[model samples]
Target chain A: MKVLVWAEHEQGALKDATLSAVTAAAGLGAVDVLVAGDSAGSVGAQAAQIAGVEKVLVAGDAAYAHGLPENVAPLVVALMAGYDAFVAPATTTGKNIAPRVAALLDVAQISEILSVEGPKTFTRPIYAGNAIATVESSDAKLVITVRGTAFAKAAREGGSAAVETVAGTGEAGLSSFVGAEIAQSERPELTSAKVIVSGGRALKDSETFAATILPLADKLKAAVGASRAAVDAGYVSNDHQVGQTGKIVAPEVYIAVGISGAIQHLAGMKDSKTIIAINKDEDAPIFQIADIGLVADLYSAVPDLVARV
Target chain B: MKILVPVKRVLDYNVKPRVKADGSGVDLANVKMSINPFDEIAVEEAVRLKEKGIASEVVVVSIGGAKSSETLRSALAMGADRAIHVLSESEVEPLAVAKILKGVAGEEAPDLVILGKQAIDDDSNQVGQMLAALIGRPQGTFASKVEVEGDAVLVTREVDGGLETVKLALPAVVTTDLRLNEPRYASLPNIMKAKSKPLSTKAPADYGVDTAARLTVLKVVEPAVRQAGVKVPDVEALVEKLKELGVA
Candidate 1:
C-alpha cells in the first residue's frame, strides 16, 4: 500500500508536528512524505530523516515559500492520487490543507485522529475531547490529519528518504496574507511548550493578564493560554483560547489562574503533566484536578506570585 | 460571486456534553442543539461576504436528521439567501457529505465554498477539503482572514510555528479558524425575516445518494479523570518540592 504525508513547515524548517503526522501515516502503508515551502528551506532535508518515510516530495518556490492553501491543495491532490492514504498534522496548516485535499480528491477524511487501526480506519476524539470515536474512510485515497502531540518525535537514526519534486501549476482564488502580530514571547510554541500558564475570568483585563501570567510563562518559558470564557469576554484573542471550542493542549505543566475548571475547560488541559489552579472559589472544579491549589483573590495572589517567582 | 456555506447541528457548545449511560453515544435527550460554533463562523464569513458585496448570493446547506433544519434556520437567520436541507438519518461521513455537496455544486456552480475547520461535535475538520477535492478545486483550510480580489483569494492562516499567508484561485474551499470572525447572534428582526427566506427540504435519495454510516461509532468512553496533587504555601517551598519531584 502507498501512503503520503503532508509535511507542514514555515520559512523552510519543518515544524515538529510534521514528524508525528508522518508516524501516523506510516501505520497504513509504505509511506512517502511531501513538503511545500521555499527552495532554501530545511524542511526538505528535515523530512528526509523521518524513520518510515520512503520519499519526500518538495514543491519549493517563491509562491510555495509559505504553504498557502492554494498551492498545497492542488499539489497534494495531484500527487496523492497514486497513494491509498494521505496524512497531515492536526495543526492549523494541516487542518486547512487536509480538508481541501480530501475535497479535491473525492474521498473521506478523518480529522484530529488519535490512532489508525489500518489503511482507512482512525480513532479520534469527539464531544469536546470528552469521548473517543473510531471512524473509517473509504475510496482509493483516504486522508487524515493527526493530533501531533499524541506521538513522540522522529528519531534521527533512521534511513534517509529520497527527495522528489512536484511541478505544481496554478493558484487557488481567495485571500491574501498581509502580516501577523505573533504573541510576543520567548517561550515555546503552545503545543510544543512544556509549561503552559492559562488565565480565566479572574483576569479582569489584559493588563492584569500580562502582569501575572506573562511572568509565570516567562519564568517557565511557557506558553500563555486562555479559557473560553476569557476569550469570549475579550480579555484575550481567540488564538489564545484553550478549551473544547479552542485548542487542546498537553503541556508538561499547566497553570490555571482565576479559573473555574469546567469539564469543557478541563478537557483541553487535563493531559498536562502537572496542573496548578489558583482561584478564590475553594470549591471550584479546577481544584479537583489541580496538583497545586491556591485559594486566594487573583488581584493579591498575582502580585504575590510575581514577587515570589 | 456565489458562495456556499455548510453547517452542522451539534450539542450547543455552551452545553456540557456527557456520554450516554448505555455506552452508545453522547446523550442528547434534553440538551439544546444548535449550529456548531466553527460552522457558525463559516456561515458568518459567507454572510459577511454577501453583506460586503464580495459575494452576490449565499447558499447554506446541511445534511442530517429532520432536526438539522434548525441549523439551516440559523444560516437563514444569519443571512444566507437560500437553504438546502438534505434529509438523512445515517451519520454522514466527510466523503459522503462532500459528494452530496458536489452534487449540489454541479447544479448551483458557486464561486467559492466555506465551512468550519472542524465541527466541535464530531471534531472532524474534513468535509470542506474532501468536497474541494471532489470538485477538483483548490482549497484553503483554516483561514483566519480571507479576501476576495477578482478571481483570486488571499488568505492569512495560523500555523504551528507561526502564521503563514497564501493566495488561491476562485471556486476553492476555505475552512474557518477561530480568529476568522465573531459570528453575530440572529436578532429578532432577522429571525422574523428568516421565516420568509427560502428553505427547501429534500431526501438524500433525491440527490441519488445513499446516506449510510461509512464510519461506525465503535465506542464512547469518557476520558480518564485526573486528581489534584501537592500545594506549597510559598515559592521557596514550591521550588524545593519541584526539585524533590525532579521537575524543577
Candidate 2:
C-alpha cells in the first residue's frame, strides 16, 4: 500500500508533528510526504530526510501559502491517485482539512487513530478517551488523522529521498486570510513538551495563576497548561487549556497544581509518563492517576517545590 | 441574512461513559442526553447574531432519531426561530451527515452555517469542513469569534499555536471552539413557547443522500487504566522523588 502523508509546517520549516505522522504512515505502507506551501522547498528537503519516506512531493504555489482547507483539500484529492491512504497529523490544520478531503472523496475519515491494527482497521478514542473503538473502513481509499502523541517521532535525518514538484490548484476563491495572533513563547509547545506545568482554578485569578505556575515552568523549561476551570475563570487564555475539548498532551513529566483532576482534564494528560498532583484536597480525583501525589496547599507547596527543584 | 446552526444530541458531558461488557459499544441505554456543548455554543452564537440584528433569522437543525427534536427544542428555547429534524434511527457518519446538511443548505439557503467542531460521543470533528466541501463554500472552523461585516464574515479560529482570523464571503460554514460564548440556559417561559415553534421533519432520502455506515466497529474497549501511586509527604520528598526519576 502506498500512503500520502501531509507534512505540516509553519514559516517554511517542518513541524515535529509531521514526523510523528510520517512514523504513523510508515506503519501502513510506503510513505510519501507532501509539503505544500509557497517557497517551501526547504520544508520538502527537510521531509526527505525523515527515515522510511519513499518520496517527498512539494507543491510550492502562492495559493497554498496559508494552508486553507479550500486550497489544500482539493490539492490532496487531485494527487490521490495510486495511493491507498492519506494520513495527516491531527493538528488543528489537519482536523480542518482532512474531513474536507474525505467528503470530496466520498469516504468516512478515521480521525485521531491511536493504533493501526490493519491496513483498513484502526483504534481511536471515543467519548473523550473514556473508551477506545476499533473501526475498519470499507471505503476503497482510507483517510486518516493520527494523534501525534501516540506515535514516536520518526528519525529526523537518515534517509535521502528525492523530492518532486507537484502542480497546485491555485486559489479556490472561497476564503481569504486576514491576520493571525500566534503566541510567541520560549517554552516548548504544550503537545510536544517533555515537561508540563499545569494549573487549575484554585490558582484563584490570572495574576496568581501566572505568578505561581510561570516560575515552576521556567525552572523546568516546561510548557504551561491550564484546566478548563482555570480558563473559564479567566486565569489564562483558552489556548492554554488542556482537556478533552482542548489540546491533548502526553509529556514525559506532568505536574498538576491545584487541579481537582476532572475527568475531562485527565483525558488530555493521563498518557503522560509520570504525573504529579499537588492539591490541598486529598480526595481530589487527580491524585487517583498521579504517580506522585502531594496533599498540600498549592499556594505554598508550588513555590517551595519550584525553589527546591 | 439567515443563519443555520446544526446541533447534535450527545451523551451529557458530565456523565462518564462506560463500555459495554460485550465490547460492542458505549452503554447509552439509560444515560442522560443533552445537546453537544459546542453545538449549543453554535446555537447561542446564532441567536446572539439575531439579537444583534445581524441575522434576520436563526434556524437550528439536527439529524438523528426522533429524540433529536428535543435537542432542537432546546435550541429553539435558547432563541432559534425554527427547527428542522432529519429523522434517522441508525448512526450517520460524518461524511453522510455532511451530505445531508449540504442538501439542507441547498433548501434553506442560509447566509451562514454554524456547527460544533465535533461531537463529544464520536469525537469526529468532520461535518463542518465536509459540509463546506460538499456545498463548495468557504469554511471558518474552530471559531472563537465570528462577526458579520458587510458581505463577508470574519471568523477568529482557535488554531494550534494561537488564533487566526479569516474572511469568508457570505454563505459560509463555521465550527465553534471553546471560549466562543457562555450558552444561556433555557428560561421557563422560553421553554414553554418552544413547544409551539415550527419544527419541520425530513428524511435522508428526501435529500438524495445515502446514510450507510462506511466503517464497521470491530469492538469497543476501555482504555488502559492508570494505577494510583504512593503519596509524598511533603515538598522535599516530592523533589527528591523527581530527582530520583531524573525528570527534575
Candidate 3:
C-alpha cells in the first residue's frame, strides 16, 4: 500500500501534528509526505527528517499559500493515481480539505480514525466519543483523517527521505484569504502540550478566568484550555474550547478547575495520563475519571496550589 | 438573494447515548430527538440574513425519514420561508447527502448554502465542503461570523489557532460553528403558522443520487471506561500525590 500524507505547516515550520500523521501513514505502508505552500521547500526539508517517510513531494507555489482547500483538494486528486490511500491529520485544515478530495474522487471519507484494524478497516469514535465503531470501506481509494491525539508522533530525526519538487496547480479563483487573527501565546499549543490546565463556568467571568487559570498554567508551563460551558459563557475564546466539538488534547497532566465534567468535556481529555479535578461540587462527573480529586472551591484551592507548585 | 440551510435531526444534546447490548449501534428506540444544535445555528443565521435584507428568502432542507419533517417545521418556525423534505428511511452518509444537496442547489440556485459543521450523531464534518466540491463553488467551513458584501461573503472561521477570515465569491457554501449566533426560540404564533407553510417532499432518486452505505460496520462497542481514583484530603496531600506521580 502506498499512502500519501499531507504535510501541515505554518510560518515555514512543520506542525507537530504532521509528525503524528506521518506515524499514522506509516501504519498503512510506505509513506510519502506532500508539502504544498509558497515556502514548501523549507517545510519539505523538515518533513524529510520524519522517521519512516520514504519521500517528500514539494509543490511550491503562491496559489498554495494558506493551505486553501479549494486549491489543495485538486492538487491531491491530481496525484491520486500513484497512491492507494490518503491520510491527513484531522486538524481544521485536514477536515476542510479531505472531504473535498473525497468528493472530487467520488469516494467516501473515514474521519478521525482511532486505529487501523486492517488496510481497509478502522475504528473511530462517534456520538462525542460515547461509542467506537469499526468500519470497513469499500472505496477503491481510501481517504482518511487521523486523530493526532490517538497516534504517537514519528521521530523527528534519523531519516534521509529524498525531497522531490512536484508541479503546482494555479489559483482556483473561488476563495481568497482576507486576514487572520491568530492567537499569540507563549505556552505550548493545546494539542501538543504535555500539561493542560482547563477552566470551566465557575470562573465567573473572563477576568477571573484568565487571572486564575493563567498563573497556574504559567507555573506548570502548560497550555490553557476551557470547557464548552466556559467558552459559551464568554469566559474565553472559541479556540480555547476543549470538548467533543472542539480541540482534543491528551496531555500527560490534565488539571480541571471549576469544571463539572460533562460527557462532552471528558471526551476530549479523558485520555490524559493523569487527571486532577478541583471543584466544590463533590459529585461533579469529572471526579469520576479524575485520577486525583480535590473537593475544594477553585478560587482558593487554585491559588494555594499555584503558590505551592 | 436566497439562502439554503440544511438541517439534521439528531439525538438531543442533553441525553447521553447508550450502546446497544448486542453492540449493533447506539440504541435510538426511545431516545429524544431534536434539530442538531449547529444546524439550528445555521438556520438562525440564514433567517437573520433575511431579516437584515441581505437575503430575500431562507429555505431549509432536511434529508432523513418522514420524521425529519418535524425538524424542517422547527426551522420554518424559526423564520425560514419554506422547506424541502427529502425522505429516506435508511442511513445516508455525508457524501450522498452532499450530492443530493448539489442536485437541490442546481434547481434552487440559491445565492448561498449554509449547513452545520457536523451532525452530533456521526460527528462527520464533511457535507459542506463536499457539496462545494461537487458544485464547483468555494467553501467556508467552521464559520463563526458571516457577512454578505455585495458579490462576496466574508466568513470569519474558527480555526485551531484562532479566527481566520476569508472572502468567497457569491453562491458559496458555508458551515456554521459555535459562537456564530444564539438561535432564537420559535414563538407560539410562528409554530402554529409553520404548519401552513409550503413543504415539498422529494426522494433521493428525484435528485438522481444513490443513498447507499459505502462503509460496512464490523461492530460497535463502548469506549474503555475510566475508573475513579483516590481523592486527596488537603492541598498539601494533593501536591504530594502530584509529586509522587512525577507530573508536578
Interface RMSD of each: 3.1, 0.7, 0.7
Error of 3 at B148 (Å): 0.3
lDDT of candidate model 2 versus the reference? 0.94
Question: By descending DockQ, how would the candidates be arranged?
Answer: 2, 3, 1
The TM-score between candidate 1 and the true structure equals 0.88
Q: List candidate 2 stretches off by more than 4 Å.
A: none
- Candidate 3 structure lDDT: 0.94
- For candidate 3, the per-residue lDDT at A129 reads 98
Model 3: residue A38 alpha-carbon error in angstroms: 1.2
Candidate 3 per-residue lDDT, tens place, B10-58, comes to 9999999999999889998888999999999999999999999999999
* Predictions in order: lDDT: 0.77, 0.94, 0.94
- Stretches off by above 4 angstroms in model 3 are none
Off by over 4 Å in 1: A118-120, A138-141, A157-159, A164-184, A232-239, A306-309, B48-56, B138-140, B143-156, B161-172, B187-193, B230-237, B245-247
Displacement of the residue A291 alpha carbon in candidate 1, Å: 2.4
lDDT of 2 by residue, A162-236 (tens): 999998888998898999998889999899899999999899999999999999999898999999999888898
Highest DockQ, which number? 2
Whose TM-score is higher: candidate 1's or candidate 3's? 3
True-vs-predicted CA distance for residue B1, candidate 2, Å: 0.7
